[model samples]
Target: MKTIHLGVFEVAGPQVGGTLSWPHPRSRSAQFHDLDHWVHIAQVLDRAGFDFLFFADGYGYPSVAGDLPETAARGGINFPSLDPAVLIPALARETERLGFVVTSSTGLDHPVQTARRFASLDHFTRGRVGWNIVTGASQNTVAELFGHTTMQAHDARYDQADEYLDLALRLWQTSWDDDAVRADAAAGVYADRSGLHRVEFAGEHFRSSGYFTVDPSPQRVPVLFQAGTSGRGREYAARNAECVFVQGTTVAHTAANVADIRAQAAQQGRDPASVRIMVGLTVTVRPTHDEAARLRAEFEEMQTDETVATLYAGNTGIDLLALDPERSLEQLLDRDDRGPVGQMGQSNIDRFLPKDGSAAPTVRQILDDLKGKGTRGFQVWGDPVEVADELEHLMDAVDLDGFLIEPIFDPADLEDVAELLVPELRRRGRMPQEPVAASTLRERLIGADGYFRRPEPAAASAHREP
Candidate 1:
């Protein structure tokens, strides 16, 4: 079996994103812009041997209730959303091995700029960079800002994304031969004009004339990541994603997702094993079970049910606040299947305890679960050994490549895991004592060691310019 890779998802706040169970009215009490915390966390992850730090992004805050804009802004609910790419350069300066992966929506950004930015970061990070691709999900937000009237249909968005990827690949891979740049100060020449080629692309969604603004970085194209299990989404991942992030509530559900993507990869003539599937998990680990429980309870008390409902409303595009308290998810699903909240209901109803034994969990339960001090992803609370056992169980049950671990409250969460849990995992033969090697992100993850090498300088042509 291949060594399992690990990653952590960053949800910038005092606590994880999602709902809280605390009863007191919530406020913007948490400090959001402590760059020190981010830098410290990046160093910890590098020291802990994590594969990457993945940041999930959205273009706009949740807009559901008539008072959403004000409510979200005032409450600091994902309000200080900063560009993740900007943070990577700082993080890259602090750590050597940990990779940086960030989400950028194709729908919201121009392909030329997006392509150049990632390439620049890859160079800055020395190949430890990845891109998580997403299409814009909120139309109201886009319409308000960019003059768009609406979001594209679900399937149509994927269609446009396909063209966008094709254009990006042509610019990154085919635009210039590998040896285009030659920095020879003696001759006062930089590029070999013969080896450079321009890529002219025209499609329904985008048209770009490109000579890649940035030279090929350590890895010409950073590792690609996609998070979607829909039919169109799976097809997109197979052709593009090196690793796919899956969000589902159960091992069984995630296994099905992994199978679907692998099957899709095989159909595309790509090795099914080439695509690595990682499930989301939030762990609260300690020295003893009792201590873990107490910590969890504290988190629970700080969260509120209303917060959960508000968040659910924004995610599903259904105002859970408007529905009757006793309404079943069966009722909601019957009305619409256009968004993620509905899909979460169908995909994860069994993992949660139903409020009245007829539908989804109550807003209170959602808050309670989310607010638990060491909660997020798939919650498993225990001692180091216990946590290791659970990790093994998840890896086996879900057939996962590894986990996208979310720190309960801070980066210290990862530090504890590394100190307490990593040793136990190594003793059990689940993880390696020494890292494989420091190489390109693809080499590190895919075992494609010899596949990548620095390109030789392109030959300078001495042509008659007279």
Candidate 2:
């Protein structure tokens, strides 16, 4: 058995089903649960041996088909905007070991602001915070907020984000000394003035001319996470990210992706092992195989088609609500072939349908397979021992660092995993029992017991191993 890290994506509000008219609020506690309900749930995950609670956020709802606000309002989907990073401090207060990862797009805000916010979070949490780096996917986000009529070209956005990251790196990594902050009550000074450094950067997309206002926090920088899987996105992750998130249906596809990413990391002059790749997994565990299958069946029956459709529509950028059932996914493929989503158009289709076999799955088929794809990273729905066996197989096959656990149900679903699945992993010597030390997020991720050290290279190279 091998050790693996695990994370869960926690969304605000009730989860939407596949279609608009279908049941939008799928949570049984929709009537009783609110935002704070999620806060308490975060606390639960922290105590349940989860490495982190990763949150997926969006500035605008799925409004590309027609009017934006109307669709969001009618569906009651992701409308109310609450910056997920703001909620980290609250969660940090409730637990000691669990980490927090929140999405913040390079397109939505300036690098200075992003740098300041995440740096503050790292400080507040004592280093248990990660930024899920994203370039906004919607055109409406810019049009409504930034007064832009259309989105920048996909490749162009990545280019801008590249510069944005460079600027942020300057602020977070190069701006202050490790011992810059010296709290000396006798000297009546909190931070040593001489230890501060200024970074001067001028780029096509972003520019910074002064010293960073904040001193270096624990970990110096927050743990970096990237989800895009395009060639350009992979290169960006190789150069900048500590963790790369991948999603796919089959183990072979995921293995190929992991290999590709590690190869890229090696080329970037960084230790390939330094870049931890985590794939999303959805698990349904019970005491016995029969019980687990029954629970999985119950979840599939409860899944809402509309909710899944809304999510798919948002990703493919073709409003499934507006498309005819006969139209092929090939028709929606962008000619320029850029952006993370555009690059993944075919892969996403393949995850739902057959590759070179079907044009694309129907809207209903996509919703029907939601559970399967949700577990595409790896699905383990069975008795504790059976699920553990599958998990070990996946780890050996892909050399995966861990899984991004997506609970098909609510927080209770997490409790079930904790009760049934975690112990099995521990029994197999695949997961640790003791909570990680109260340390920085980076420290917890790659440290020994909970201490930081310079990253080391992988044991074998692409050619060396193969």
Using Cα atoms with residue i matched to residue i, what is each candidate's TM-score against the true structure?
0.86, 0.84
Best by TM-score: 1
lDDT tens readout by residue for model 2, 1-466: 4478888865554442222222423233242235576676677777767789888776655555444535455555454445566678888887878899998888878899999998899889888888899876444444466777666655676788877877777677666767778888998889876777767676777766778898877766778899877666777778778888888567876787788889988987778887888888778787788987976676566445454555565554555555455544444454464333452233355454445564567654455666324324556788888887888888889878888877655656677788888888877777777666647677667762422222322321111110
Q: Which 10 consecutive positions of candidate 1 have the poorest summed lDDT?
A: 457-466
lDDT of 1 by residue, 279-381 (tens): 7787778889998877766766655545555555545455555665554444555664444443322223334434335556653444445443222457778
The residue ranges of model 1 lying beyond 4 angstroms of the native Cα positions read 21-31, 69-75, 137-139, 330-375, 449-466
Query: Number of clashes in every candidate structure?
Result: 8, 14
Model 2 regions lying over 4 Å from their true place: 16-36, 68-81, 139-142, 303-306, 321-327, 333-377, 448-466
Output the number of the lDDT-best candidate: 1
In candidate 2, position 367 carries an lDDT of 53
